[model samples]
Target: MNHRRVGRREVLAGLAGGGVAALAGCLGVGGSDTSPLADHPVAEGLADQPTQGPAVGDATATVVAFEDPSCVRCAAFHRDTVPRLRSELVDPGTVSYVLRPYPVVFEWGEAATRALWATYERDAAAFWGLLDHYFTDQDAFSSGNVLDLTEAWLTAETSVDAAAVREAAAADGFPAPVQRNLDVGEAADVTGTPTVFLFRDGEYRTSASGSVSYEFVTSALEL
Candidate 1:
């Protein structure tokens, strides 16, 4: 329920301080050719686009969220807003929700994102669990131990194959879709975590940066 808003200046400073910007040019271009959402029910009726991420629900309205797994503000949005959003909007099929992994905060953010996609590829339920775990226990991980911790969590808490997930996460390059998510973020001029876009009837609508409320989303959707 707590919201910690991070500004663009602070995000840019973090990127510079962590040397993430330098690594941008070196981002890997090879990995699995399969779409992470290939088997996902939410992929139905969705366009085939490089910028597409995992989706849920079927509706005329769509909500695309770009988030960093290790971002506190993102965590706040997940914790404070997601449950209500699901109950009031997604579960009712009023809107479709998509999650774009934008790892802009921590050094291990990319690793976590890879693991997330791997989990979703393996099992949607486990993927949601891993997403909640990363946000809820962000402090319990670091660059050195993000993969290990994720492996341990998947092994202990989910039915997903931990070893395969680890292998995917430890792959040489970012997964194709994850890399496309980065490209999407760049094109959208995303400045920080939890940047969300709302659309109606497949047309672009408004967007919000940082933590947002259920009311804000509904208002954007004109629901």
Candidate 2:
């Protein structure tokens, strides 16, 4: 909870300046600054999206993950580490997992995030499924045919017409939620993709970022 907010470059600098210990300190190690997660402030018609877990106050622990739909690292993390997190933490009823789309690399991530939420608004269950599709087949959506491809994938998943997703992606104000997420990230001092905040027993324990290994998740939860 230092909340000293470091950008990605600063994260790398910490590693170079003082090795793992510096990075560890930056990640809230041995810190007494216990604070709750901030309520993300979104503009009207841009409320926070539904989280991918049980109701907030009903879990023993919660892992709030911030990621960019277009980030390769986020995709890699989901592919490699999510299964372990599911088996060890979520499936056992040890914690609830919450995924937030934090826009980065605006070229594609912004629109991608918008389409993701729009899909969620239409069909909640299909949201996670499409997230899997987007991550695994990122190249398909990154093309000039992103909207058409996304629509097709979404159409294959649910009854909701994905044409609305395309509309949401192109709207002039589409960046509201993404901007709000960036604000939340700034407040949390998050500077990278796949950043996860671990809250246990109603206390903020720590956070991890990047394509972190399963060990990091397990160890953070252990505390």
Which has the greatest TM-score?
A: 2
Model 2, C-alpha of 151: deviation from truth (Å):
0.4
Cα lDDT computed for each candidate against the true fold: 0.69, 0.66
Backbone clash count, each prediction separately: 0, 0
lDDT of 2 by residue, 97-204 (tens): 777777653346667778888888888788788888878988666636677777888787687778888899766545555555666677666766777777776567
| Per-residue lDDT of candidate 1, residues 105-198 (tens digit) | 7767768888998888878788888999999998898888988999999999998999999888877656666666666566556667777777
Stretch of 10 with least lDDT, candidate 2 = 38-47
Model 1 pairs whose backbones collide: none
Candidate 1 residue-pair clash tally: 0
The list of candidate 2 runs beyond 4 A from truth reads 1-33, 36-48, 175-177
Cα lDDT, model 1, residue 217: 77
Superposed Cα deviation of residue 121, candidate 2 (Å): 0.9
Model 1, CA-based lDDT: 0.69
